[model samples]
Target: MSTAGIGLGLTGFGVFFSFLGIILFFDKGLLAIGNILFISGVIMTIGIKSSLQFFMKPSNFKGTISFGIGFFFVIIGWPVIGMAAEAYGSLILFSGFWPTLSVFVQKTPVIGWVFQQPFIRSFLGYRGKRAPV
Candidate 1:
């Protein structure tokens, strides 16, 4: 109902699309769609935050850095390596939003727990409590 709600929705789609893109990296059409959705989620969720307070945290710093490097490789590096980087970067980025993202994923009747596993959270670089509202 609010902008934040929309942002969260975009983030969900972003995750889904990124996964799809990774799956169909060889298919230009689906891969393009995936790339678009992934970027849209990041922009909607964080682009509007002009305040330094929104991005100055250590986790956010790590996430953005990972995302930036991954994006660069995905755009112009070797195919196989690029895809891997994209996945890793996305994991970190998604982890950065774990608190909020989990709220949506947890609503699912099945498989939510899988997504919330400690190893996945740690791998994605999720640390400390959920991000500030």
Candidate 2:
């Protein structure tokens, strides 16, 4: 299999392990393992140079810093707080992909039906736009 495919599998496992860690009372070891796996998987998926460039982009500095600090905290045995910071950093870092994700969700077959529900649609739809006067 290709490196990207292997990386994707690793990423999936990393996410699974992270969730498992959360479920198991925020076990630091599991969380740390998950973080390592996730980071390595990302590097493998995108290659070293591109991953460095992506993280070093000026617009991504804040997320990168927060993520780095959170990783440090996790290493230092502060799993909960570190995960919180990491979550925020992830949100900031990945916010740009939400639109693409939404599109994908809408296009999928079974999952798309759930998101197409009226209530779900309303929740996902735009709000608070004013008409031209």
**TM per model?**
0.52, 0.89
Candidate 2 least-lDDT 10 residues: 124-133
| Cα displacement (Å) at residue 35, model 2 | 0.7
By TM-score, who's the top model here? 2
| lDDT (C-alpha, whole model) for all candidates | 0.59, 0.83
Clashing pairs in 2: none
C-alpha RMSD for every candidate:
6.1, 4.3
Q: In candidate 2, residue 101 scores what lDDT?
A: 80
What candidate 2 gets wrong by more than 4 Å, as runs, is: 126-133
Question: Clash totals for all models, in order?
Answer: 0, 0
lDDT of 1 by residue, 1-133 (tens): 8666676787677667656766765443444455666566656666655524544566667766665565555566444565566667666655646667665774556776665577755654556344233
Cα deviation in Å at residue 60, candidate 1? 2.8
Decoy 1 TM-score against native = 0.52
